[model samples]
Target: MNSLRAILLGTLAAGLSAGGALADGVVNIYTYRQPALIQPVLDAFTKETGINTEVLFLDKGLEERILAEGQNSPADVIMTVDIARLTSAKAKGITQPLNDETVNKNISAEYRDPDGHWFGLTKRARVIYASKDRVKDTSITYADLADPKWKGKICMRSGQHDYNLGLFGSAIAHWGPEKTEEWMKGLKDNLAHKPDGGDRPQAKSIAAGECDIAIGNTYYVGLMRTNEKEPEEKEWGNAINVLFPTFENGLTHVNISGAALAKDAPHKEDAIKLIQFLSSDEAQRIYAEKNFEYPVENGLEPSEMVKSFGELKADTLPLADIASHRKEASEMVDRVGLDDGPST
Candidate 1:
């Protein structure tokens, strides 16, 4: 996924930084990912290479910030969750192509940008949360979510969100727009209530017997079970069992946490090294274990608890194909008023 390199000295030529000495052994990062989610990987990178990692956590506007800063942007790397956001950074022109052999080799062709703009670090499956008491089925499929049997028994978050859009995109990729649109309509018709909350809240809804099943990413269940501050969430975690829902074709849908090199990085070499290290097995283990996500690299396993959910046979529908359809997916959500619950 490598491309012709950008001008390595372009930022310096632009007189960026105004003649101040560039800091040695440091890589500045702007990330949309939560700090706690990535701290271990960053800390490990610094410990191994003696290079300091400076992260600026941003809830939003990571690309806009870099674009606004232009040649003076101190961001050496950009980290974010979801293929939609990662592709957003590339489409916004804030990321440069990476030419690292390590990154190209470690990341799969489907998970990394064909142009080498971004590489996925970890993956989380979009799975079903079935209430232990009310939902007796041991196995389920994504297609079943729309079945009449589950009418008034299903829960989910807003359809417009990236998480749901990614899942919707996969459906579109697998079944085509017309069939996928019909599928969305069926899913909307079966909603237990209006789509109004985050994935974890869907589990809480299930716990309260508001729905027999809910849609959520796999990691949230682990996060809830281990939460110390909100111990009541543990009950939500315990009340439902994680069910890796598959397509009728027998494959689950998953999304990624990925990163890109800044277009005007001040520490290009160090930033590349950081990306390389993160792709290594050691860093990947620490990363996936800490977050209960699956390593994007092949052959590496997820944390034990995550594994306890069940093995995931992920749908090979290329994420690039799915991402391309997100706009239509969102539009379909509004067209059907999916967030307004099932229309009687």
Candidate 2:
């Protein structure tokens, strides 16, 4: 009887040591997005596991915050959108590598780090949005956003914005700095308005008849169409249509909202478990549907609003290249003096 009791205790101790509950009480999530965008997923996670999930939401400077908190940070996971943001976090050493096979299989190789430090949950294409009445041509490419024909007719956010920086980095990766900077010069010269605001404002311009073609994300349209509370939002969405450009050689430009486990997480094992759950097929799909984003998981589609945009050939560029060329992109942004990032 003593031998059997000893064996049971040994098993219990093993479970406890691995952080399988009893000791793990909370999961702290640090998110760059506002709670409105991330809360539903957190709620769903809590509902499924009965584990308490808490988020420290922010609109900006989240990366600096994590780095500032350093080892003492209460964060268990860092969630951010865009390759630049994801790479910056890892570069700052705020996170450690997470090389689980489950994440590797569900998230696309192109969207994740080779070392497995971070994994993207959803996809947003940096696609072209053209005013339905103005853009009669269906063959425009991203390069065309810089065309002289588009001068004073293009609407874009600021070059310093992560999304634009990611796009610029991708361009530099594909076209090199000299050529990419030339393109930026031309594109900046063509802007209808100063680069400013989120992509939504660009779409709003299309609805208000402010521009002809807007370089924006496909998912933004989905968010508006699916959840817009105002009739004007419906109008804003209805005024524009999506175009997947440069599919002949390259896919559309893409970015992600990714998560990485904290390096010094108090509950390291539980943090890994939560990441696994978030990167799993079930969670990816639900998050996509709930947030109106494309799942990075293979063979999955976003909500109906996204699918309705029709099939797309995503930019096959590795996300790393986008982050790597950010310095050059920033220089180009300054040289061209594009929209100063929303309301410039």
How do all models score by TM-score? 0.93, 0.87
Clashing pairs in 2: 195-339, 196-342, 197-342, 251-314, 251-315, 252-315
Across residues 1-344, which tens digit of lDDT does each residue of candidate 2 receive? Answer: 45554554354345233443224666777788766777777777778777766666667776666565555566688888888878888888888998898878777788888877788898888888888887888767778876788778888887888888888898888888888888887887778777777888888998888888888888888877755578777777778988877633757778888898877776777787788888877788777777777888547766777888767777778897678899888888887666542222
Taking all chains together, the TM-score of candidate 2 against the true structure is 0.87
The backbone clash count of each candidate, in order, is 0, 6
**Runs in model 2 lying further than 4 Å from the true structure:** 1-23, 340-344
lDDT values, one for every candidate: 0.86, 0.77
Positional deviation of residue 147's Cα in model 2 after best superposition, in angstroms: 2.5
Clashing pairs in 1: none
User: Tens digit of lDDT per residue, candidate 1, span 30-141?
Assistant: 8887888899999999999998887777787777767767776778989899999989999999999997888888888888888889998899999999999988898888
lDDT of 2: 0.77
Best-matching candidate per lDDT? 1
